[model samples]
Target: MANFFTTALFPVMNQYFGMPVTFLIHGVICLVYFFFVKTSVPETKGKSLEEIEKLLQKG
Candidate 1:
């Protein structure tokens, strides 16, 4: 998704704002997705599948 937006969407946005804006937009997107994944993605390090299932159910 990120790569698709960067390589595909960014170019379309660039037509309106130019290449530098496209670069900045893509950079910001990458930064946001990086933090979003880092914070929201669970570790799942040692938890069992049943444990995860219960956790999901609770939410």
Candidate 2:
């Protein structure tokens, strides 16, 4: 999926926005994705296996 998008969409973006802007757009997208996952995902860093299972069952 990523390869297809890069091969197909990248050229169109680069043509209109140039390589720098295209890269910046990708960077901003990555940052937004990072924050989205960070805030929306659950953390199980210190959880035991049973605790994790319970959390999953609740959800």
TM-score of 1: 0.61
1-59, model 2: which lDDT tens digit per residue? Answer: 75577678888999999999999988887788899989877789999999989988887
Best of the candidates, TM-score: 2
Looking at candidate 2, the ten consecutive residues that score lowest on lDDT are 1-10
Global Cα lDDT for candidate 1? 0.80
The lowest-lDDT stretch of 10 consecutive residues in candidate 1 is: 2-11
Count of backbone clashes for each model? 0, 0
Models, CA RMSD each: 2.4, 2.4
TM-score of each: 0.61, 0.68
Off by over 4 Å in 1: 45-59
- Summarize candidate 1's per-residue lDDT along 1-59 as a digit string, tens digits: 65665677766898999988888877887789889989887666799999888877776
What residue pairs are clashing in model 1? none
